[model samples]
Structure formats: C-alpha cells, structure tokens
Target: MRIVEVYQSVQGEGLLTGTACVFVRASGCNLRCWFCDTPYASWRPEGVDLTIDEVVAKVEEWDCQHVVLTGGEPMLFSELIPLTQQLANRERHITIETAGTLYLPVACDLMSISPKLSSSAPALASNPHWHRRHQRERCRMDVIQRLVREYVYQLKFVVDRPADCQEIEEYLAALEDIDRERILLMPQGTHPDELADRTGWLAPYCQIKGYRFCPRKQFEWYGTVRGS
Candidate 1:
C-alpha cells in the first residue's frame, strides 16, 4: 500500500475528535475536492509503498489505542482488508475515514464518511478534467448505505455556505435509517477566521436542524499544519 506520514495525533474530526490516535494516511484519491486539506495525499499523491505488515508496525509504534486508516481513500487499497484485520486483532479501535464513494469489507469501529457536496467540486476553469471526474464519482449512495450499515458511523458534511446545508438535507433525504444526531455539519476553511464566520451561522443551523455541529479543532489547536 502507498503510505504517507504515519503519526500520533489527537483525533481532529468526527466522533473521535479529541481522542489521541495513530493516523495512517494512504496516498491517492478517486476524487479531488477543491478544499482538500491534505493535498499531498490526494491531488499530487506522494508516498513510499509499504507491505501490510510494515504499515501495522508503524501503527504499533504509538501507544495509542485508536488507529485511523484515513486516505486519499483507504478503501482504494484492497490491502486494507488484512491491514484492518491485523489492527483489530491487536485490539486497536479502528476508524476508516473515506469519501463514501467506495466499499471494502474491512473491520472498523467507526466508518467516518464525508460524502462530498456539489460545492466541493474543483474549479472547472482551472482543472476541467478533475472537476468533471470529481462530480461524477463523488457520491455513491450504495457505498454510503453499505458503510453506514456495516459499521458504527458518522456522516460529516463540510458546510461551505448556507446553501450547502440545504444540499445536505436533500442528500440525507435519499437515505434511510440515518441518525440525525450522528450527522455533523462542519465549517469549511483552513483558517480560523474563515471557520469562525461560517460557524456563527452553521452552528445555529445545526442546532435547529438537530445535527451535530463539528468544529475543526485541529486548526485551532495546530493551525493548518500537516500531521495534526
């Protein structure tokens, strides 16, 4: 599997937020979001290839019990089936962060699904190819249903604008059995000021809509730096 930086950091998003965990960021993604925070793992993928054992060894380096198999879309690598199994055997709480666009029958404690919104598409003028492909492949409702059904999950939608909230509502309407409390609406921005501005309104909306208001605490805790 292609591996990016593996480090121990407090869980910065989703239901696991504030918990210390080991992050195994697999390189390469099936879709490109314009606001992607980890561009190194996506747009211009970079990493060293490692055997599944090697990846497990790295995660074991930390004393942390929570292990997040995040990506570039970790589901893109079939190796995750055994990789997640190995981690589970070691008694680590596994969280797989994905775009909810693919499916792999891997063991996981939390399936952190961040279904891409239409607003997340990259500018067509700058990158027409990825813009088209991203839109085409971003939402796979079948995969979303499977992931949520197979694992304890959280649905985190990046709210870039007020309009995005309505889109999220429409998105959720298509699915069944989704717990409203597990649905999180997070502000979209790398900077604190931008996040604060959106949060002012987004937080209230989430409250009225009965969804969790997820704050990107990593930015406040460590700025927009990598390995947070």
Candidate 2:
C-alpha cells in the first residue's frame, strides 16, 4: 500500500470521539473535495509504499487498542483486506474511514462513511476535470448500502451551509435502512473559529433532524496540524 504517516491520536470525530487510537493514513484518493483537510493525502498524495507486514509492524509499535485505517481513501487499496485481517487477528479494534464510494470485505469494527456532498466538489472554473469527476464519483448508493449492511457503520456528512441540511434530508430519503442516529453532521473546517461558526447552526440542525452532531475535536486538540 502507498502509506502516509502512521501515528497515535485520539478519535477526533464520530461515535468513537475521544478514544485513544493509532491512525494509518494511506496516501491517494479517487475523488477530490475542495475542503479536504488532509490535502497531502488526497489532492497531492505523499508517502512511502509499505508492504502489509511493514504496515502491521508499525501499527503494533503503538500500545493502543483502537486502530483507524483512514486515508485519502483506504478502500482504494486492495492490501487492506489482509492488513485489516492481521489487525483483527491481533484483537485490535479496527475502524476504516472511507468516503463510502468503494467496497472491500475487510474486517472493520466501524465503517465510518463520510459521503461527499455536492458542495464538496472543486469549482468547475478552477479545476474542471476534478469538479466533474468529483460530482460523478462522490455518491455511490450501492456501495453505501453494502457497506452499511455488512458492517457496524456511521454516515457522517460535512455541512457547509444551511442549504446542505435539506440536501442531506433528500439524500437520506433516497437511501434505505439508514439509522438517523448514526448519521453525523460535522462542520466543514480546519480552524476552530470556522468550525465554531458552522457549529452554531449545524448542531441545532442535527438535533432537530435526529442526527448526531459531530465536532472536529482534532482542531481543538491539535489545531489542524498534520499527524494529529
């Protein structure tokens, strides 16, 4: 796998927030979101390539129970199947953070699916290719359905504006068997003030819509630094 940095950090988002965990960030993505916080992992992927054994050995270096297999999109790599299997065999709680656009029958304790919204696409004038590609590949209901059905999952959306709330509603209506409680609405920002501004309305919206309000605690804890 093309591996990025592997480090220890607390669960900064989702239901497992605040939990101590080790992060394995794979470098590369299938889609490009304009507001991507980890641009190094996605927009311009950077990292060394590592075999499954090397990756596993590095993960075992941390004395943590939870392991987050995150990425520019971890599902892009086929090596995850055996990598996750190895982690699971060692009894580490495995969480795979993906965009939910791809599927892999890997061992995952939590399938943290963050489906990109239409607004996540880069502007057409700025990057026409990625804008069209992002729109085309962002949503995959079939992939989402299979992921949710196969694993314990959470659907997280990054809300940038009030209009996004309605889009999320329409999105959920189109999908089947989604647990609203497992749907998390997080503000789209890497800075504290930016997150705070969106949180004011986004938190209330999540409450009214019966979805979980997710905060980017990493920003608060580490201030948008890499390898948090």
Candidate 3:
C-alpha cells in the first residue's frame, strides 16, 4: 500500500471521536478543498513505502483496539480491502474516513464521509455550484448508494458560517432517506479553541435540527498532536 503516515492519536472526528485509535493516513486525493488540512498527502508524496504486512505490524504497535484508515481520501488505495479485512480478522474495530468522492466497494465497520460543502469555493464564483451539482450527482451519491447497500456511512459536513448551512441542507435533503442519527455537522478549524468557538454555533444547530454534532476530540484534548 502507498501509505503517507501512520501513528497513534485520538480520533479527532466522526462518530467515534475521542477514542484511542491507530491512524493509517494513506496518500492521494481526488479533490482539493479550499480549507484542506493535510495538503502534504493531497498535493505532495511524502509517505514511506510499506507492504501490506508491514502496514499491519505498524497498527499493532499503536496498541489500540480501534483503528482509522484515513487519507488524502483513504479510498484512493485499492489495497484498503485487504488491509481492513486483515485488521478486522484480528478483531480490531476499524473506521474508514473519506470524502465520499468515489464508490467504496469494500465493507468496513464505519464510514465517516465528509462531503465538501459549497462554501469551499475554488476562487471561481461558479465552482461551488458546479461542484455541488455535478460532483454530488457523479460521485458522492454513488458513494451513498453503495455505502447504504453494505455499510454504515455518516454524512459529516464542515461549515464556517450560516450561509454554508444552506448548501449543507441542500445536500442533506437529497439524502432524505438517510437515518438522522447518521448525520453530523462540524466546524472547520485546525485547533481545539477554534472548534470550541464554532461549536456554539454548530452544536445548537444540530440539536435543534435533530442531527448529530461531532467535536474534533483529538484537538479537544491534544490540539492535533502527531503521536499523542
């Protein structure tokens, strides 16, 4: 597998946020969001090469029962099937973090899909609409369809302002059939204080709307530590 980095950290996002997890950050991504956190994996090649077995051994060292296979969109790797299957065979619980930009044919325990919202414009005024319109129809919906077919996938959105929630609602409404408990809204930030500040806005939004609110626990506790 083409791995960018692997380490132990609190799960900073999703349904299992705050839990101890072994993070397998794989390389490469399909989209370049305006506020991307891990540009090194998205735009740069910076991971050590490791075979499937080597990768598995590394997970064992984190000494955690739970593991997160994330990315520059972790679904970019085809070997994820063998990797997750091998890990699960050992009774280790696993989560797959993705953009839902591609169909996930493999069955993992949890799928935390953060669909890029319209507010992350690409400088061009029409980019957000074009992306939300075509990108969702072409990739994201197919992901949702496939995910619902086999695994539990959550719809996690990152919002910065009230306007962002408009686009988020548009996307969520399209997935009206999804179980409400599986949806989450989080604020975008690199630090815990930032998330803490925006949580006041987003947390109430979720509570009132009956959707889930996800806090970035890694940041809450360690503020993006490398190996905490």
The clash count for each model shown is: 0, 0, 0
CA lDDT, every prediction? 0.93, 0.94, 0.76
* Candidate 1 deviant stretches above 4 angstroms: none
Q: Is candidate 1 or candidate 3 better by TM-score?
A: 1
List where candidate 2 sits over 4 angstroms from the true fold.
Answer: none
Candidate 1 RMSD computed on C-alpha atoms after optimal superposition onto the true structure: 0.7
TM-scores, each model vs. reference: 0.98, 0.98, 0.87
Look at candidate 3 and give me any clashing residue pairs.
none
Candidate 2 lDDT trough over 10 residues, lowest sum: 202-211
lDDT of 1 at 99: 92
Choose the strongest candidate by lDDT. Answer: 2
lDDT of 2 by residue, 1-228 (tens): 999899999998999999999999999999999999989999999999999999999998999999999989999999999999999999999999999999998999999999999999999999999999999999998999999899999999999989988888888888888888799999999888889999999988878878899999988989978898
- lDDT tens string, model 1, 29-106? 999999999999999999999999999999989899999999899999999999999999999999999999999999
lDDT of 3 by residue, 84-167 (tens): 889989888888888787764665888888887656544456465545543443247666656755777787888877787778
- Clash pairs, model 2 backbone: none
- Stretch of 10 with least lDDT, candidate 1: 9-18
